[model samples]
Target: MLRWLIGGGREPQGLAEKSALQSIGEDQTQNPYTELLVLKAHHDIVRFLVQLDDFRFASAGDDGLVVVWNAQTGAKLLELSGHTQKITAIVPFPPMESSKENSQLILTASADRTVIVWDYDTGRQVQRSCFQSTVKCLTVLQRLDIWLSGGNDLGVWNRKLDLLCKTSHLSDTGISALVETPRNCVVAAVGKELIIFRVVAPTETLPRWDIVEVKRLLDHQDNILSLINVNDLNFVTGSHVGELIIWDILDWSVQAYELNFWNPSAQLDAQQEIKLCQKLNDISINHFTCDEENIFAAVGRGLYVYNLQMKRVIACQKMAHDSNVLHIAKLPNRQLISCSEDGSVCIWELREKRQLPAEPVPTGFFNMWGFGRVNKQASQPMKKQQEDTTPCFLEPVGDLIGHSSSVEMFLYFEDHGLVTCSADHLIILWKNGEQESGLRSLKLFQKLEENGDLYRAV
Candidate 1:
């Protein structure tokens, strides 16, 4: 089953001879990852992977070293070393037109309370600055040609590394995450609160740039773990508890709130089996990614698809992985990719399920959102509430098993393939088997023609 799911050297077989599981695994839109290349560079667990350009990406982690790799070929290009401690955050600095050449640059923050900007092409440290506290997160405001660093306080800087403005200390716990919103506003997740700040550039009357704290949101019940901008109109934040909130970007008001993740009656399996209980930590929203229509959430070991228009969970897998899911990414064509602490990466498709004419119409919120309905039996309430109300279900398509430890996160490079970093101290470049085979055949034919052997081969 594993071999067939990952397309492990198996030739295509007839549909008539395939099992139901094999038929789903062989769907045309299933995961195309078959060939893989394991890249080794960091000695410690790899935690972060950031793309630098179309064909290059960088990986950093507890090893205190950042290694750049060619995503297309999985070849190590440069090893950037300067940080004396584990890297906490990394973001790319867009190339400036004023430079002698449009050289790609990257900014990295470390536990050593310092941030360094490096020119990836030359492997040279361009600028370095010491911070009062370790920068936990970094956000680039490309429109303004500046960046912001969040830690004990929020600091804004320009391309030359000059501190333009900063805020007073707000929290000892420091800012866990930061995201840019429209209209020159920034949102910082500090402990259990969300602080909104507006960046004001110098004008004819102002004469100086400033960052002003606009509002404070005190809705989350626990520490905020994940925060991201969904679109120009709204942004979303997930808490250490099972709370997920969507906030209006302009007014900083709660647009939507969901706490149903902890409701035991909502946990339903494919066979309509009810999961009675879940630990508190298991329901924490670890990460979030989205497309235009839905928000994909990595909640504990499960993967959920929440529709923005409907404001409800349209599809979900209560136990998508064997362990806690660390990160998730939305792929094209209604597909999702999630990595877990169990040392595995799984691909899922949000396929629509046909509704039966005999099925009763759902009425309650739980049933309406596909959380299942209570059965007629009185004693088995847990087992009763195991039905679906939505029209979609997450189908397991492919499983990429190579890492020996936790798979931290991954970056999808389209034609270049998928790049995943792991706690096993390895980076695996997963490629489309069929596309790679065609590329190899094309290269061979080109070589044969160059050597004047094409006619003999034909």
Candidate 2:
């Protein structure tokens, strides 16, 4: 729920398209984009963290307090508290500029099967909804003016905080995750299949939940753990079997696959012949990240970056983090930020300075370089003006403090504060502190864009 309210003006339609790769191999140049702040915890666990735009940031833990911090100063501003159980997810809704709303709203889902909407200005819950089933995943679609929530069931809620539409009918799938598109359609990974649903509030029919099965590619060697819509057409699906499959949403077919584990069947399952048993034994994909430039997926051991478009593995570092990564977020500026069960948060430079096979996120391949800007063609691959590699991971500029537990998830709100939630039962917010020296390296190409070292001379 990042707000484009950066002084709210004109937003370029979207990025152009790019090529979709099958796998990332070695020799591919790869790096991280933004500097990461590994917030240190002092108590139970630092469950999660998030940014609230440019104003504030929040982080939560089992400690109960949702610490709000200054985005630029990293000063603790306030605390958001109220949940009795573990907080699972946190999202910030940047009020529409036209609405003239002063403060923003923070929405949190907890293991208590409850969703709390907070008015950060006062650090209190303005409203809340209780569910009998645990809330597994959540995504807010402003385009459709609705919020989609999934747990034991998939449902939709309106801006008025009303349960406008819901159906326990999909209970069979036991929805786990959700992703929304520009058109406002909601795609959910529920049951044994990937279910696509749209929100429709007809003047005649009671708001309805339309379930469209995109692909029944079932018999998952294990549970369909997570479904991420990288962009509009290309989505990535992760399974308990450690096999992550990237699918072409438009065609409802598997475009490529990442095999971290063994799959019982080959259909749509990303399988590879890895002679090394250690690589596949417990290589869990806890997170999937894409710079819309290159692709990186987190395994049980470390992070694996590849140019799926070129089918080359750019970089694979073992023991980058202590445990399996819990989640990964690609920043708006094309940086990769991630949090893991290892109780650490890391930011990496994503732009490779040299040419590398482009393997953007599983789905955003079409929209990464602004491909879907015009809806050119389905089979079209994206090509950039330069084959030059851009430095990926810049460097960690700052560190966040407060959470006392394992940081499960963290996402930047772009020029705003960061929002994170953890199993510790609270959501922590991190305000973007001062730009560290690392940002200087970011201008490497831009300064050198015009002439080789001549731009620096002039």
Candidate 3:
């Protein structure tokens, strides 16, 4: 019975050959997610999923609603409704040490130009504040016990929702992303520029907290799309034209850079495909995720793994998906998961490629053109070039095909499995089939023994 539940039963005569081909062609031995539970709550698209605790997570999106769920049992715990428009950003706001009770809190920003703090345990809105413009992003500074909001301008607030300091209107286009750095500094991506700001805490001479712009980085040629702090010493940013720049956190200088150009002519010989015109979105860098050593990037419909120490691409899959990938994440055991506009989520593993003794080891791809320290005043743009064959490869292990429209993002809970939210207005909780089967059998045996059925059968 348990084997049948996991699709282990024999197939019909006509379908046997087809099933055998699938099982042999696709290697699913390393993939553990064979069971899933579909969860539906939102009427519109579900865009964001944030983990609130070990066994719980909250999801919010275009429906202008926030729903909390139990990761272990696939149960709906709470439904939070306050925003009049769609939600743009959501983050967990952990409790301080001095608080009376250890209630979990969350912060959500919406297109209605309001930010609300909710206590999800009681399904109550603890605090709410309206802004002059819609807040597109939110980042919490846990060390300073304050949060920052980004939109047309930058604003800082305390846990009590009191405005502490704010910057003057920085850009009409609004800030796209925000990330905190060491020494009380923050980086904001506005249009094509990256602005560095310093936050000054109140002191004896200063009566109020202040935010001052330190520098403006104009390295990117196109609009910045993604920004992330890789570690304490460096941060990375991706642009609309597929240019990836790694910046030093201390001085805000470019450490390494690369332009991921997708040349149509290169694919003509191998695939016999000809593309007359290429759009800006074709090679756009949509998102990035990183581990301790490498940065995984979702560029167009492909995946690229770049090493920070080597400062070069180690491995890449030019066409990992049928459509543009929206989000990617690094999982344990050298595994990676990515979701795309094609409405599919895939699992991949990084494996070292075996080489023959006669073949010489390839050098770094960027060796011809030195890219160590970039000249800020250089007039010429970096030329588009193909990457050399790498020593590693990404092997696809499993596919989760369920969403009909698009899979926006996903969350990986180490023990609770994977939770994915999609543009189809549905969420899926993928569980390990083998682990769940064992748990079910153990429970059944325990119940039978308690009811004396085990002794009677013996």
Candidate 4:
């Protein structure tokens, strides 16, 4: 009778274990990363987001739904359904004026090991191409009408979905990131190594493209995360160990300045700070982007900005998110936008601090009032103007929160606003504090929980 009342031992092992874990409050806590309004987007966790243009964006999730949104009004424009598994990537194909048939298209990859090209405006799948393994990342060569898909191997294909070449010679460990070179070569990062492949093509070959290994640069001790093009001949890479390195494309040599796990900055001191650096080294770099002056790297839970001219880290904000920052994008207005595994989106702006006057102001008058001004001198407007113009630090300008689970990715649209996707199965459209409606909706669940009616409501 006791064994029967306890449900016996006949229950599946996995089910019993899951029930015990739930009873111990494994997944019951409320998500702490809420800022603005929330939108219920997907039936499962959102996985990727991409900006279609200045006004529209798309998000794909585990529910196999690709949702398009009007960036300005936060309205759902359309929902595309086709993939049978979790979506891996969503990339926007820039419009080609040369190809009249090519309007705007979106290319999406899924865990089903298939890449689907969709006419994003019409919400119709145009073509589908299968791969041998999961497509981890993708890059497009717009001028050449070619695209590279990276996974266990690298596959080069044309706009018509014809596979030009497939090669595993670059890296057996798998391609982590890909970039193009000025000399028509391809740079592939695999683990801690950077492999440069020179491309060759024959006018009448069955496989139209071929890649030959030219050079392999091995400077990092950890897995490389993201690669950024500083200029035509200069590039930068961030690693899983919080290391940043700049590479000269001409000679593929490392630059003088380096940000690594060993406290690359001479200003870093103290045992506690050193220990903190050690902990940071264990964290990973998730995304990277830059404008003309600064390189922004989202590493672990922090957002780090490095000054290119100064060749040093000028600002590092720890806990930019409660968890890992997954993606980052720089807006047209010089604002930094980032999303994280903590289910939060934050916007950052840079501004310079006013420089203190070199000469002291007159203090005699202030002494009489117990708040004396310093001695005054001639104005130095030129120096002050220069000082005021230089960007001193990155400051948080705004935050948009809505997701109940980890935010996978976010994209910024200039004509519209921001679009973010989360693991909570949500996609939120945010503007500049126009409407704050999620506050009431997010609280309704909490009220139910407090009243002990949450289970019944669910």
Candidate 2 per-residue C-alpha lDDT over 298-364 given as tens digits, one digit per residue, 9 for 90 to 100: 7674666656566434555445566677777666544566676655666554444555585544446
lDDT of 2: 0.57
Residue-level lDDT for 444 in candidate 1: 94
Compared to the true structure, candidate 2 yields what TM-score?
0.63
TM-score of each: 0.87, 0.63, 0.85, 0.73
Q: Total clashes, candidate 1?
A: 2
lDDT of 4 by residue, 259-282 (tens): 432343335543444357656533
> Lowest-scoring 10 consecutive residues by lDDT in candidate 3?
15-24
The residue-by-residue lDDT of candidate 1 on 1-458, one tens digit each, is 23333244322222121112121233344568867666777878899999998999999999889999998887789999999999999999985556565868899999999999999999999999999999999999987889999999999998778999999998899999999988899999999999999999999999988999999999987899999999988899998766789999889899998766645354454123213334656778999998889888888889888889999888889899999999999888888999999988898989999877775654676755456543432235344132356669899888887666899999999988898888877787888877888998999999999999998878
TM-score: the better of candidates 1 and 2: 1
Which candidate leads in TM-score?
1
Of 2 and 3, the candidate ahead on lDDT is 3
> Please, what's the RMSD in Å of model 1?
8.4
Superposing all C-alpha atoms, what RMSD in Å does each candidate have to the true structure? 8.4, 16.5, 9.6, 12.5
Task: Return whichever of 2 and 3 wins on TM-score.
Answer: 3
Error of 1 at 240 (Å): 0.9
Candidate 4 stretches with Cα past 4 Å from truth are 1-38, 169-172, 201-207, 260-283, 332-334, 354-391, 433-458
lDDT of 1: 0.83
